[model samples]
Target: MSCMQHLVALLALCLSLAAVAASSNHLPGGVNLNERFFNQVRALIKRRMQEKNCARVHCPLSNVHLQPPLVDDEVALQNQRSYDNVPIPAASVPTPVLVENWPTEQHSFGQVTAVSVDPLGNPVIFHRAERYWDVNTFNESNIYYLIEYGPIKEKTIYLLDSKTGAIKSGWGSNMFYMPHGMTIDIHGNYWITDVAMHQAFKFKPFGSKPLLTIGKRFRPGSSVKHLCKPTSIAVATTGEFFIADGYCNSRILKFNAAGKLLRTIPQPPEFLSLQVPHAITLLEHLDLLCIADRENMRVVCPKAGLKSSHGEGEPAATIQEPDLGRVFGVASYGDIVFAVNGPTSMLPVCGFTIDPRSEAIIGHWGDFKNPHSMAVSVNGSALYVTEIGNNHQTNRVWKYVLA
Candidate 1:
């Protein structure tokens, strides 16, 4: 027999022997030793299988190019401690004013999950249509199990004119289970994440079918072939992309243009363990990859191409304000970073701009019911925010322009 078959047979023999022994001898306190032993063996086998699968699927990196340091070593040390003493910019910072009666037609939506400005400056929205995410949307394994009224046929992707907000085109019918995040790469390709599908997709401009798909269908795993409820994706000009495997696996995974596994971004020692990396935004000008560490209520900015011997590196900067609430999304225009947060006991629902270098809160804007995701215009003249809406009703996307 082959090596794998022989190993499997050996494991089966050991399990059988354990079962026989456990049935004959009872553990103290009336515990069922057979059940306990079986559960332990099952967990061990599952973990080993996952590791094997990951090793088999992922390609090893022999040499990784690292980006130059964002700052001198001494200055970097100072910035590391800047979080506690960040200077609060004056209130004179400009806050974008909401444009009223926008979209003109006032199209209705179910739950606006994500919004991104395409290369042509048009806003593309990813919504849930008639589907809703609730307590039972995912089972214990983080696999989407709630299918209501069969498959939803509504178009989930909508491309609107940047000026008039009129729908230019729409597609994505009968595809995706639960839409979570969307981003338009520099090349105009759409990178989207589906929490229910546990997958990320890359679609050509106005394309109905995806040109590339990552992760296994309906399977939630941390292996190279599986993603556990991935939340968002950010693509670099070089075609390298980062995916926030948020819901279950709290890690950002990097992949190449052809969808090859690259590496799992290492969490910075200074920051708390990632709870849920809800959104990711790449600041190309600054060579920074920023993440919305949702439950941790912080934005971790790591050097874009920085890698260690193992093809992973620490974050260069972070924004963790007590009053920032739960940061739901992050976007960047030039060196300026923009973040939006849901309401909390200490702060109202608001969006704020930050100076990435100084890690300071520069400006703030508010009045959102539930700001879930956002996108900034290429020229830094406008911002678009998507709201899941209150009570699962009044789902809307709002546009704001810099004054």
Candidate 2:
């Protein structure tokens, strides 16, 4: 209660408050700690110099030296040379090395419609027109004679050795009108579908002659037994073949190994808006058939063994526009199903893969001017895409390494 006791209590309270402020300064991210350290070091140097009447200014590399001297083991250990090393900057990523020209074959024949590997692993490429001849135009040269517009001339297919990169053999008789699709079965046989001719022909592997023919002439729905411009095809593991009876016809024709018309899977009328069904593939695991409905810009799956239109049950799932943008080729390999965008100069050659579980487009790759056809490597690591743009007389096949 006395004045002296009150002054003593007030002084003690002020000192305690100053100590609390000093303790808080030691906490992380505190501005006062740095300020106090610098201020104390300046004051110490100034006092020492003034007292010693020293003319030189003293400076220490670190402000920690300004702290009170202590012989504690912890302080000595902390003062020892720090083992923490300064971080070095990371190196830049290296650029990818691009392989020069690949798929070392050039075909002057019009848009290569289909390519298949024979029993010998040789690639058989089928094309519409023959090579144009300049120097041999008038002469009866082999190149000029094969492509001349004479009554005996027609479209043809050539077998190229995969390793030697040479056309081992080729055949074009008076049969083909426009050979648009071809496939080699395990039996080493060759099957070709002629679009303009409205005919399907099966030939012996090395046999130059046709063993069987389906249609007599070009006619839409001429008979369920015949096919009209069947654009794409797939032969299932069971030896059962499927074809997209494309162009003028909206029906899908399925046949047996013996060339018998086993069944017809027609498109839904609801998707009548999708007139041109370009490609077809049988996802055997799901017992589902996927058709690339090109004009409608989507992929439609009509369950296998269906006889008539079911009115578009579902697209398996719709592909978002511009993303699916006129998908022309549909192929399923392993967990990845690839579809290539149609030839649009604006859109690079892009492909999309669906995650079967989610049926979602999970990955995409671009760098094609006009990607026409795609084939997945047996191992599924590389994808071979054919580009047919810029009046390309000789189409280029690109091999994309997938991640």
Candidate 3:
């Protein structure tokens, strides 16, 4: 017989012998049944088995008892004396299975929108926290208390040290109106989006001052400066940036190194019918910009200038959105782009990779709910996702080791 077949036969023979030996044993309850029986079976397997995946083998002795070690008569007396006819209280819920190695990061009251690996391999999470002051004016909650008579909404961006699991640095004290998106560029500048403020801002690595603003005095109902909301951002290798104009606006705004508006790529009429343009990416070749048309549920590719609309150089191709509905973050590795799906109210973050050439979804896996944002490692094998779940009552981030 072949080697594998021979090994299988040997295992079968050993199991049969074990069955016979176990049945023949008649040890009393006082015997150390777990120690003796398990040791014997383990010894047998080690001598005969040569499986690569097998590091160790285990054999159960019998059903494990819940009672503390004591004489049978003693246990019966305690049970009988408990009460007249009252029964022992039973646990109402089933025990939960604990997972090892996987650690969870929790935040009190903030939504993590962006994450990047620091120099030491720890993650830096940027979250927009809310501070309530009455009902009318509440900016994104950076501080915990309400402003006496301040704006109903004030948004702030914080730089959190995921390693120490603390807020490392914060900038937007009373500055931001609705800080929705942020990214750390190669030059170390932080690019943030303030949709309510109608501006895209660039700040020095932890600086509170805004280095530059894209749309000043921009407001809704006016296409001159910006439409209504500005949502997400992406930076290219050369330091140029793309802003996904969200809400009332449906366009991709491009800026140069000096932060001057270079061009505007308005969305196709078909896509503008949707609500927001959430995330954008500059393809590796510098040949195009990939726009995550959030409401439209598709990634749109536009050539260099990203002109007004797609005719020839825009959207070289497009991929159909996954069934998960809306996508928040888009990252590219080689020729594939990965998207994070589901809301922040659940678990089992879902992700899918797309093959740009075929405009086809290459792979998909489920089990995530309410993942606020996601980022892929420089190498393409690992994906990090931030989760905000309700019942869990935790704001956490998880890393998935991709096969």
Which candidate leads in TM-score? 1
Predicted model with the maximum lDDT: 1
Q: What are the per-residue Cα lDDT tens digits for candidate 2 across 356-392?
A: 3333444445555556566554444455556553345
Best-to-worst lDDT order: 1, 2, 3
lDDT of 1 at 366: 55
lDDT digits (tens) for residues 1-403 of candidate 1: 4323433455566577666667566554665566654564565455445535544664221111122226568865675533323333333244678888887887878799999998878899999988889887888878678755444589888999888789889988888789999999878889989888889999997687789998887888988789999999998888889999998888888888888987777654534378889999987766678889889888888767733332234666787654466889898876678899876542457787876666645555656767899998776778899998634446888899866
Flag clash pairs in model 2.
349-368
Stretches of model 2 off by over 4 angstroms after superposition: 1-99, 105-107, 131-155, 163-165, 267-274, 305-320, 344-346, 377-382, 389-394, 401-403
TM-score sort, best first: 1, 2, 3
RMSD for all candidates, in order, please.
Answer: 17.8, 26.7, 22.5
Stretches of candidate 3 exceeding 4 Å from the true structure: 1-105, 118-122, 131-171, 267-275, 305-313, 321-324, 343-349, 379-382, 388-394
- For each candidate, what TM-score against the reference? 0.75, 0.61, 0.61
Model 1 misplaced regions, further than 4 Å: 1-94, 147-150, 267-272, 306-312, 390-393
List lDDT for all candidates, in order. 0.75, 0.55, 0.54
